[model samples]
Target: MKTFTLLQEVVHIPTKKKGQVITTKVDREGKQMVEVKYENGTTGWSIPEALTNFIQDSVDHTGEFLSD
Candidate 1:
């Protein structure tokens, strides 16, 4: 299992709201997933592909933050 430590995905949400939190991870099966984790511990999820594209575009724009 792998986990990303930052709320980088929150920026990708088009709504642009603050105070929201998310937790994204890769399960043992390697499927990419995102969870909207709240301060209260409840959560929701989305396709990591959206984040993949967001990161890709950012890298293309600034040539930074590449991952392996």
Candidate 2:
């Protein structure tokens, strides 16, 4: 588990279905990225202030999640 912030922007478009959303974030490297969150609580992306800079696929129950 890690800590990060989310910007109110869409790096990419996501499904309008429940629990599926795409957001834009500035990672720890200061790179703007697109993140897609799924209904199952899994996610795909890089978030602000994260340790890694790659899109990851994992469940994130925490309100705050960082992609690997």
Candidate 3:
């Protein structure tokens, strides 16, 4: 897991649905962040670590994916 402090304002994010494949970009320090644009034309930011734990937990329960 990684963390970051945003240096600049994000301009856009593509729409994403549940279970959709999304893209993440990391800074030089390896902080994982996702850029998302909302329906109302607002950008949203999220850290992968915030969701990684939950996803890993779910996968662990179902044995569908492996977590390290």
lDDT of 3 by residue, 1-68 (tens): 54323332232223232232144687778777775443455555566543322233344354467689
lDDT of candidate 1 vs native?
0.49
lDDT string, candidate 1, 1-68, tens digits: 33344565343255332223366567778786776554445556655433333343456455578799
**lDDT of each structure?**
0.49, 0.44, 0.43
Error of 3 at 3 (Å): 14
Candidate 3 regions with alpha-carbon error over 4 angstroms: 1-23, 50-68
Pitting candidate 1 against candidate 2, the one with the higher lDDT is 1
Regions of candidate 2 where Cα sits further than 4 Å from its true position: 1-21, 38-41, 46-68
Candidate 2 C-alpha error for residue 51, in Å: 21
Taking all chains together, each candidate's TM-score versus the true structure is 0.34, 0.27, 0.34
Local error of candidate 1 at residue 29 (angstroms) = 1.9
How far is 37's C-alpha from truth in model 2 (Å)? 3.4
